[model samples]
Structures are given as structure tokens and as C-alpha cells.
Target: MTAVPAVALRGVTKRFGASVAVEPTDLDVSDGEFFSILGPSGCGKTTIMRMIAGFESPTAGTIALDGRDVVGVPTRRRDLNMLFQSYALFPHLSVEDNVAFELRTQRVPRAELRERVAAALDLVQLGEYRGRKPQELSGGQRQRVALARAVVGRPKVVLLDEPLGALDQRLRKDMQFELKRMQRELGITFVYVTHDQEEALTMSDRIAVMSRGRVLQVGSPTEIYDEPANRFVASFIGTCNLLDATATGGVVRVEGVGAVPAVGATDGDVVVAIRPERIRLLPADAPGGIPGRVVEHAFLGDHWLAKVVVGAAVAPMQVQVPAAEGARLLRGIEDGAEVALDWSAADARVLPAEPAASSTRTQEVAA
Candidate 1:
């Protein structure tokens, strides 16, 4: 931890005439760590990547690479590489040529260029595709070629802006494992930008949740998901059931559901946030439980995702039942069938009410 950070930003801000794309912010990416800047569209995630890649200059503040300020450095001189969502490979060049283009431009020796390009392609398991042009490869294979090109120079940090966004779900998942493996083996710092919450949670060592051109919270994946800093983070990082309620001593009382265990809030309006998987279905009319009815259900492979409307809950709360357990309980679980729901008090967290938004802007709870 004592080593100089691979990348650092101090009071970084970007202004595009009248629009502020990124607010003043401070960030430090540790050496060899997989760090992700996660947020929805237009939340400044891509602007952050552009700033780091030297494509866009910040209106204020400094950007340092390996502790050395590089505000005026051109992209080629900065010793950093950017991988875009588009492959951007030269159609005129073969895969090997595409991967070797950067090194060749740098005037690297022929033998060393060949060695580095081969090593990079091998790292991504694309050695055999070297002779084929990018137009001949599948989306996933072309992505690997782009990945190989990015790392052939062995930059200290690599900026990836939704490089896998174009692939299908199955291919994207497969690429995630391959990309993580490459990052670990190369021991390079990764500055990844993505809007996909699950991708960030699965691939990043640490994540910075951004919103409204500002950083809401920065922490490890577990901390960001389990102990989100605010309501924005709580609702954004995963699927959460947000229940509006009034907080009393050690509990939040719901209008129709009764008292619910809660903490860290005063005697006023608050919210209780719980994940879907943590809730359990109890026998109808069970003691210390809230009564509800199943209004909808869906089959999601390993588990059944169902929405239960409890009298005390402000809206239909989602519940996840294991396939085996769901089979036994689903006989009594149908549209309009009676049921009861209960969850561990520790599983539910108290959070502040959402901040009021400007009427002109679209209101959304995103993940």
C-alpha cells in the first residue's frame, strides 16, 4: 500500500462549455489493482476514462501517472493504452499486424516486436488467429485481438471503456473470466469503465460508484454491494426492495406490515433496504411474519423469482426461492394465493430517504 499509486486524480473536473461532465473529484488507483468506475449512461464514467487516456483534458485539477503529473502529455507519449467498445482494428491489417501496429509505430526492434506481440496474443489465447484479419474474426475473437493490442506494449495502466459491451451475454461472461485472468497474470493496473453492475461486482477488486457527475462511494465490491454508502448506492448496486417507513426506537414501523427491525436512523421518515434473496416465505398466518400474496412469478434456472404483495410493504417485494424449496412451497403460491413472509433483521438495512430531484431531469434508480 505504501507504493506510489498507478494513477491519481486530484480535484479533477471537466466542463464542456455549459455542461459539467465531471465534477471535482479525487481518486487513486493502486498499483496492479483492478479498479472500476461504475455508473449509468452519462454519469461521467466514460469522461473519467477519456481524461485518464489523455483524449480529453480536464478543465481543472491534475492527473498523475505513477506519481508523475502528465496533464499536457499526448496520448502516445503517456505510456497508457485505451481499449474502446468498438474493435477499431485496421481492416487492411492482419491480427498480428493490428496487435503489432503500436509497437511498430514506436520503432521497436523487429525481433522484440515479434516477441511482445506473440506474447500478448498468447496471453489472450489468440495465437492461432494471428494470420486472420479482424474482419474475419468473431466479435469475441476480435475483442481478444483488441485486448492483445492494448497489452502488447506492456503499459503500466490500461483504460477499458465498455470493451465487452457489444458481445452477447454468454460471450461476455466468458470474456470476463479471460480478461480477469489476463489482468492478474500481467500484474497491470486496470481502469475499467462500465455501466453493468454485475460485471463490475464480478471483475473488480474495488469499485467507485458514480452518479450525477460525482462519485457517490468507492470501496471493495463486497463493501459497495453489502454496505452501500447511501440510498443511491443501495438501490444502484443490486436488486433491493426499498420500503418507506417511520423509524422508532430500534425499529421502523410499517403502515400495514407492523414493526420491522432496523438501526442507524432517527425517529423520522426513513427507508428499509433488503435484497430479494435474503427474504424467506413462511407458512400462511405464521407468527412474527407479515401476510402477503404472490402476484407474479418467473423461472430463473437455479431459483424462482417471485413478487409478493404484503399489506405492510409499500410495493410488491421480490423474493427468491431455491428451486427445490420453491417446488414444495409453490403449490400454495399462485396468483392471489395467501402467504406469509419473514427475513432476518440483520439482512435488512436502514437508509436515508432519497434526495429530491429536479423536475427537469429524469428520475431513475439504476444498477
Candidate 2:
């Protein structure tokens, strides 16, 4: 973090009647950083985004843009641009006009406005589409137009709210790269809000995982994924197998299974989380393995997903292996056949059981 963040939210809170949309939270976004606020619907990610964009004022606390308090500033005067999921293009306007709307609104000189607009369009690879309208362009191309318009103003930060949610899966993935490239080229700070885990993981330089109007964790993709702060974060970011266990003599005694080696600090009641990909199938009675029955299996194109009934919990332990390798491994093992599961001790993350949840006092504003 620099002396002054590109966008800073200090003790920012927003309440709607008795419902808390966002609690008092402190966030600092660095200059040129690609930061995302990720959460499920009703998690207040959007509310926080609106507050930062000046669409909604925080119920309490301060919002600073480059160390300057902009709580009372208008959106346009705040030197920020908000890109919405809807292209929000004027249907009657040409591509160039759509990108030039902000500049014209600010009454920039005709000559300089043209130069900036052309540069913006060219950056998005839509230089030739200037003569066309939003309706004439493909969804991806229209999205490019929206992006060009967002950066055309050269705002200090661009707030994007699910900007790619409308595109098809493949097209959306493609735009992730395009958006990343534009962000780098423009060197503008981006505060993106998305509920799609894959989308956030793919595009964010750093992500703040939010739940119930509170940020559960803030870290890089690897940090949030590999070292989650709690069970909510671990389960939300990716697939996780949470099994009950008890710590004793540097080993976790899993219910209905043998003892497994533990790492880090493990004490009292605990939950062990092992990723499906980390587990390996072995013949029953193999050393350092727990025997179980293969309850179900599915081919997922890139890999195979297997459910093995084991441990005290009724839920089966999941195992995933490369499609080709899985075929060879299960060559003779029929469904319901007995097998053993093994994984490196280091791969298993032992977490404390029943971590306390925060009780932040806040609510969202009413429409």
C-alpha cells in the first residue's frame, strides 16, 4: 500500500432500514491494481461498489480518492468511471459517439476529444467499428465499446460491476484477457465486483471475499485459495472436503478412520480439508491409506470425479484424477469395489473447528 491508496474506504458502512447491506469495513486499493470484491448475491459487494462510485453514499465513515475525501462529490467530479453489466450504450449513438459521450459532456476541445476517442477505440481493437452502432456489433464487440468508453475518460479508477456477466462462457473468458490487457496498458486502478468465483480468480490481481456484507478475506488468488482464513472462505473459493478430526500427539484422529499426520498448530477439535485432486486411490490394505468403497464416479472431460464412502461422516470423500490416468487406475475396480485413499500429510489443511463469526452492526439503504 502506498502513502495514499488509489481508492480508500475507511470504516465505511451502509445500512438500509434495519437490514445491513455493508458493515463498517476498511479497504485500500493500490494504484493500477486489479482488485475484485467477490461474493454471492446479497453480500453487499454491489452496495460497496455503488458507494465508491458515488451512486450511494455510505451511512458512516470516509471514502477517499487519492487521499482526498470525496464523500460529497458527484460521480463525474470524482474522476471515476463505472462500467456496468449492461452495455448501457445509447442505441442511437455511433460507437465513436458512445466512447465520446463523457468527453463531450465535460466540454473538451473538439480536436483533443477526437484524438482521445480514436486512441480509446483503437486500444479496444474497435477502431474500424467507429461508424457502427451498438446494435450492429456482436456482444463481445459491444462489450469492447463499453470498455473503451470506460477508459476513454482516463479516470483514476474504473468501477466495474459484473461487466462480463452478459457474455457467453467462452466469450466471457476471452474478455478476461482483453480486460487485463487494457488495464495494464492504461495503468488505471480497477475495482471490480463479481459473484462468479472463476471470473474473480481469473481476472483479479487481488480479491476481497465478502459474505453477509462483510469481507471474509482479502488476498491474492493463491493466498485466498491456498491459505483461506476460515471454513467459509475455504469452501466458497473452491471444492473442499471438511471432515471432523481430533488432534493428539501431532496426528489428527479422524472419525471412522486411522490417524493422519498433522502440520502447523493443531489442537482440540479440528476439521481437515483435503482437495479432491490431492487424494490418490490405492488397493485396499495399502500402507498409510484408509479403505473405502467407491460409491460413484463421473467423467468430467478434463478429469474424473469419484465419491468414496469413508470416515465417520456420511458424506463421501471426493477424489479427482486426470481422465486418462483415472481410466488406467480404475481398470479393474468396479463400482462399489473397495479401495484405499491416501494423500500427503502436508496436503491436508487442519483448521480449527467452530471459529467465531463476526457480528458487525450495519444495514443497507432502502431504494
* Most accurate candidate by TM-score: 2
Q: Using Cα atoms with residue i matched to residue i, what is each candidate's TM-score against the true structure? A: 0.94, 0.94
Tens-place lDDT per residue, model 1, 76-161, is: 88878989899799999999999999999889999999999999989988899899988899999999999999988999999998
Q: Local distance difference test, per candidate?
A: 0.86, 0.87
lDDT of 1: 0.86
Off by over 4 Å in 2: 355-367
For model 2, how does the per-residue alpha-carbon lDDT over 248-356 read when each residue is reduced to its tens digit?
7677888888686557645688888888898988787888788889988877888888899887777988899888888876655678988889888888888778742
Error of 1 at 257 (Å): 1.7
